[model samples]
Target: MTMPAFALDYLPLGAPDFSKIKETDYLPAFEKAIKQNREEVNKIVANKAKPTFENTVLAYEKSGVELDRVSNVFFALVSAHKTPVIAETEKKVMPMLTELQNEISFNKELFKKVKYVYDHQLKKLKGEDKRLTEELYKSFVRSGALLSDEKMERMKQINLRIADLQQEWGTLLPNATNNSVIWVNSKEELAGLSEADIAQCKKDAESRGGYTPYAIVIVNTTQQAILSSLDNRNLRRRVYEASRHRADGTRQFNTFPLVVEIAKLRAEMGELMGYNNYASYSLEKTMAKNSDNVYNFLKQLIAEYTPKAQAETKAIEDYAKKQMGTDFKLQPYDRFYYSAKMKQEMLNISDDEVKPYFNIDSVIVNGVFYAAHRVYGLNFVQRTDIPTYHPDMKVYEVHDKDGKLLALFYSDPYRRPTKRGGAWMSAFAKQSGLRQQLPIIYNVTNYAKAPEGQPTLITWDEVTTLFHEFGHALHGMLSNCKYNTLSGTAVARDFVEMPSQFNETFASIPEIFDHYAKHAVTGEPMPADLKEKMLKSISFQQAYALGENLAATCLDLAWHHLSSKEIPTANEAANFEVEALKKIGLYDEQVPPRYSTSYFNHVWGGGYAAGYYSYLWTDVLACNVAEAFQKFGVLKPETGNAFRQKVLSRGNTKDQMEMFTDFTGMKTPDSSGFLKYRGL
Candidate 1:
């Protein structure tokens, strides 16, 4: 009965001893943790005493401590740094975990007690107590606790299958992306790329066994970043096609089959839960409340933005024609390259001109952390004594305004072959007053690394990404919730993105931008005119940005809005995506979805299934909040503290919209902020 290294609490809390964790330890840790969790639940269920708030709801909230700890570390490693052993471990452990969840949810005695507490003590309980009791009861119902024995059994099966399918899709994507790299044998094909970029390509080639002189590694998105820089049209087309077709059946790690299976299974799961489709079931607890609202929101934006997007495309196309002669027809591969050219010509700015001021280290320390320090009176000190899972990671101890240690922050900013694409924030431990735990948060990004001894310069997009992810980290770090279930980023899907997106507003603020955007080698600030041009160019591609996002959101809705009978087959998935986009009037070959269906990890593998619209939904709230900040002085500590108290720290303890209203002094969020923020 010895506790595994991962299951045991670190002496200081928040910091896991990564050195003691092994590839072999995960399975055993999961097994022991699951057993321990089951025993704890049994203890509550077997209690002969009358069910009360303390004996039932609170007990359930705290029951799975060991399991949560083990699962957190295991899953964090699996996503951020997966190996064959971890992948195999996930395959075994996911089903076991799902089965354990079913057992708890369907425990008749446990549900009866939870129901008793919720029903009888409902009005007597107040604040988080009332909220937790209600939430726990609803959670049990959502897990099919209210179903008949027969239906519950079927529900359990569907849950297991869905989990398996999601895991399969998740496992396939990174390999698919890695395998989808476009190799170029000649240096001539890599023209227009910087020396640093070419060096990184060679490094990537060497890392992948050196079959080619250079390799353009495909990212998780439909559009490859290199498309904006590569001079060779054929090479650009090759990279773009590889990105779009990644994880399709044409690739070694095809996820098309898994996508079809997962979507259909999810629809079936929703039907069992008495919902029309998965989107209904999933959006029940989100701020959007239902699929209709989400659709309406997206459609309104689509109608407004489509004309603008087309106009933007026409402008770029005209510019391309002027440069390459009227015979040039702009394709998807040509979008980014010509858009960059048009942007430079129109706005007198380019990513290269701006990137020198955005050294990754400076952006993090001077830009992201500096913004936090100014607004929230927080400070970050590097903790080199701590161990990390990867050498690229740096750990910092965060201190609050009062000089008390608040949280531990971990930054993983470089891309590697094993690491997944995109950026995210997660926690090793979440803050909770009840549990007396401080947050241990990490932000992971896929910024391409510079060669050793070279300062890593990032584009403005990556710079904003650092701030955005840290916004989620700040949510965790600033949490003042009493219950573990209601802490940190545990709010509604739609509401959770608000804090992160709101954090992005600071990235462009003059005070913070000037602090972070320093010359990498010269250690000097950007010239004033150049800064103005960079700032003005923010809205230069608003059409394409909004168009891609709208397409992806619409695609998410299309898949989840379907009933089981309407779900597409594996082979039909690609065509289904195109048709869905066309139906929504977003089927631009030049402006594809931010993520295509086969490799849409957020929907198929990640927890965002039927919920990717949260980005757009929450942007409404973020923009309104940003407007409020702008009115009250963006860098004012008073404004920061108000937001920290009213929004970030509150977590899921209150209604999300109510929390927003409380901070912004508005009855409803103003959607006008969306257009204003986008500069449309």
Candidate 2:
């Protein structure tokens, strides 16, 4: 009920001086929010009325609105705009956040109230509220709310330790990448790599590895770009192994011990809650419903994608062998080199030739921002008034028709040593009806940093990725919900990805592409012939991209859906993936999972955990949803507004399927749409 007289109070209400952020202020702000949240939680628990959906569930939803607001901004900035002081602050607060979650999930009196209502109150409710009640009840139960005192204590310890390990996992990924070095002796060995990439490798090498060392910085993945492009097999192997063995190596950053501990703790927690595995515990409220549906979905995709994947691998092997004029087994490093080369030969399309048109600024202003403006009657103008934590940050004001303020957008585009490697969209401000708030969204991507004079040209894939992330931002910006938890991107994990992945379709659309695909120096629109090739080029390597992603999804499900006693060890888990992929016939030494087990941030570090399959599941929805637009025209305001109303604005207030049907007028997705888009 109290408001602060600070710049943070109103985002885009005026210019914010971001440089003024102090480490001292966060602890106080965070502590106050936590105390306030607990008070709200107390009101819910101590309410005089018998537990009812409105009194209990909605009260619980409203309880943490302020904390969610403060913590989301604080944590997002901690990761994206980190200083050592802020990082230390994050270290301090994470355990506190973990404890708060434990308090709510393990509240006995609250559980009893919720259970009574769940068993007796459902008949009194109908439609979405009923589903919401059931979901809230099951979440508490699955989180071990009903456990006896002894087991509850153990579950608390396990949950807290897992939270600690997750922090360890995220913190180490960037550390390993920032710390590791691969020194190059000669330019000859770095044959196929671009000068920009080579220069970066050299700078990193000189900084960390070489005698004036030219170390290529590590990315969190099994295969490295230097691995594929470098002619030296030994160097390639070293790079591949370095990236693969990250945090699991014999150094202090090792997470192998932590991984086993987290798994064991999760299983123990599962048993306490009466679930057989973590997936069962985690999936109680997810779109997949339970492990069986999730398993079946993964298996079906594996069966369908494996053959196409294997054939693609065989083609790569054939290319590598003929090029080498000898028989040598293709290893992980050989994959990307051969795949890119093969695409150039087969489709006459190379990313290098395509990259010129996709300079980052053009893609944002002309591509992403333009599409959003045209489709939704919104516009973006850059802001310097708001303070950002970093010099690299760019802020935007998003406005709807009649110049009504809609959202705030920020982007951090170039790679930095402080940043963890990869792309993600997150919120500094989430939309909510409780506070009458609008979204303030931030997206971060770790593209190769442009040198002093170079333009920030991006690969075609990266272009799509930008559009994809912004789609999630759009979902955030457009949200209209009564609760913070249900607003914007707060839907079920399996359904959360639908908006983002669906936005990727716009990146390659003829209308959107032509607007943004201007040459950096020439300022000329991308030639139509080249544009056609680029549009067609998007699908050129579908087999490899599809297979790698599917492998990771399947592997995630397989590892997490285990019976406690059957949980596979890391080595055993890797072998299982090999066999599993082989069974689906996609198993090729040349095509590894997009994320290797050790480095899978989704499960171990990020929120996805057992839920990475959400990407694939949502891809099906994305494919189907694209058809809605194709049928009614891509920029059709009628269709767009309908979807925005039904799906975007509805958030977690209704069943996702109901929302989808409301927009598409169908309960089941058009399955062939997914296949057609993937070239299956």
Candidate 3:
């Protein structure tokens, strides 16, 4: 019998040949790739020559190309444009991949070769070679390479269990999100929504074959984006309840048991790793070295934000009473509604007024790509020749200043039942100097799709998100590292977000904003008065935003900081979350934590775990760097080149803080810049 030539085996230079891919191809491709990778590993362990950095470490670095190729494309599709076949494929393939990882992590002969290079040949290496050798050694040790055989086997089982649960939760989470959509019986209940929005909801209902005149789909957050404009209190309550209780209801998708089990397993693993708790073990590799530091940081934020949040809540309540009845009590659903009203009353600005100027296409070509060209001298040309995973996905060819090919970028934007919630950047291929590969990166977002023949106008917040995810893409595209493992966005979790957040500063710049913020139909730039009002509205609800974010971080810490004995059962999870919020003095009836535990995918299903604090932690660094860019000249090539050299292109070859100081001439990360920006 002859085997078929797999799409994973052959591809064009820059992009994955998506047209050649089929769901049935994954399992066989994975099997063949794993075998090839294992054979490659065997060569390293069985080499007759002395274990030099070239013979051992570098060989190991480039060994798993085929496996990496399959996993990258598979996972990217599973998140961005999934189907039932893809979901089922993920459920089957994840365990095989996990087992393979365990085999390599526990390969004692391989560990000996890697350690020999570190112990003997490290000083003889130079630059990224030296850094790669050290990172390889540390990676092995950290993956239980030094554990006794008995403990190693146990660790392997634990890792496999973790992988299984993660795969299961990945499927359940999105289903739960879709299942939680609130169906309305009449159009009168959707009074505050625009006609386009109401029509979209009706279309959603027709597609889902559910009750009624409209369907309000819940995004993967505690508060729905539409909650702000929803005039009916009961309907708002329904949407809020559905979002907050996602994956926690009596349906088959409830994640309560999975949450408890995941936390318990993480606790046990931490104990085995000789750490105090999972948080300690997770934080060991982050800039914040311990749970205590995270706690202290959150406490300071609470002290600063609590009073301001109280004042904001009082003002909102007063406005709510005037709008509703005097006896009406402000609820969680009312927060955004009343806050938007308050912002409008105070500044005469609203999302509706600013959205028309932020058509998605203009924001991308004129706004996002324009800013990139100004700062970095990078160019993005659309490519229709390449195939994409979905019809909606757009591919671009990115070129460096001297017209050198940098990367192939794919953009998949819009929401559907099959696609997951939120926006993110991912790579189908990563850059590597040894193999001489350029990056193949993609950005995925869940912006609501407009009706056919209608423009996809976006809010100001979505405009910032466009810039933010592209910031991450820049990190991947600009990376100039030698080894694949240490390339592009591979820095410490706390440090990885800095580049992306810093790029968000461009969203509000006068030149950048004027370039992109044009009316969808008329192509006119936003009016000066509206632009001024929009910019001033940045700090309108700063305290609540910061407080809720801090609360979520604290909640993540509280769950992971517990000992094995303290891992709560499923029933205690909700109460545990409330108590945790209260303990941090961040509990507010109107402002719930940004994500409650049951649906907090960042900590549970996503890789964040105890690292959710990275957003704020990196914000400190982002502000410092952004301030430097402002002083030096935001659009100057010199400033951009300095940042690329000192930070973005360096990967993890240097300490993150040292890289920041080198770029900005700052002695330490200053939160004052972030505080001033937020008006906190």
lDDT of each: 0.88, 0.77, 0.86
- lDDT per residue (tens digit) for residues 426-448 in model 3: 89888877767888888998887
The predictions' CA RMSDs to the true structure, in order, are 1.7, 2.9, 2.2
Q: Which candidate leads in lDDT? A: 1
Best first by lDDT, ranked: 1, 3, 2
Candidate 3: RMSD to truth: 2.2
545-599: candidate 1 lDDT, tens digit per residue: 8888889988999999999999988889999999999998989987899999988
Estimate the TM-score of every prediction: 0.98, 0.92, 0.98
Model 2 has an lDDT value of 0.77
Better of 1 and 2 by TM-score: 1
In model 1, the number of clashes is 0
Across 203-292, the per-residue lDDT of candidate 2 in tens digits comes to 666556466436677775566655535667777787777776665665576665556666667766666778888878888778778988
**Model with the higher lDDT, candidate 1 or 2:** 1
* Candidate 2 all-Cα RMSD: 2.9
Per candidate, the number of residue pairs that clash is 0, 9, 0
Which residue pairs collide, candidate 1? Answer: none
